[model samples]
Target: MRLMPDEHQVRSLDHQWQLGNTRGQMRTWGRGQFRWTTFDLSVERGPDGKRRIKKTTLTDTADLKNPLRDAVLAMGWSWRARLSKL
Candidate 1:
């Protein structure tokens, strides 16, 4: 069987969450009208004291809402907490 890479989109009513590496640790689901190429990765503690992650998409950067309304804004926030650090 042929194989293909997973896919994701920005839209409303979409809830994406994952934890992995830059190889394929992206969760994108929602609505919007922006074109994104990729998302940058970084390690930062969240306000919840859970040692959460911080995503910075290559395009959007205004606000993040599942099922996003703007492609650029849909940057990255896959509901994931952190990568496996393996």
Candidate 2:
């Protein structure tokens, strides 16, 4: 599945800008109704002074049966991979 941000979504992303959440992500799926998932990314320094990416998924929902569940999950992982590159 392709995740393309629409005009409204781009506008909503302005909130992230305002909050200085440069490394966060927000994604949604579904048509008439939607399921949203968000990730917050942060960086912390360890005792060795190394930096690492910390990610947190902000949305929690029941895992109901869906025919496309596997594909959707795969897509989410692919998205995460792309994020890691950034």
C-alpha RMSD values across all candidates: 15.8, 14.4
Tell me the tens digit of each residue's lDDT in model 2 across 1-86.
23434411111111111232456554432222234466899999878999988889875332431334455555543222121112
For all candidates in order, the CA lDDT equals 0.42, 0.40
Q: Model 1, range 3-78, lDDT digits (tens) per residue?
A: 1224233222322444667786665543323333468888887778677667887754334432343432365422
Stretches of candidate 1 above 4 Å error? 1-36, 60-86
* TM, every model: 0.25, 0.30
Find the number of clashing residue pairs for candidate 2: 0
Residue 26 CA displacement from its true place in model 1, Å: 21
User: Best candidate per lDDT, number?
Assistant: 1
Per-residue lDDT value at 72 in model 2: 51
Which regions of candidate 2 are displaced past 4 Å?
1-35, 61-86
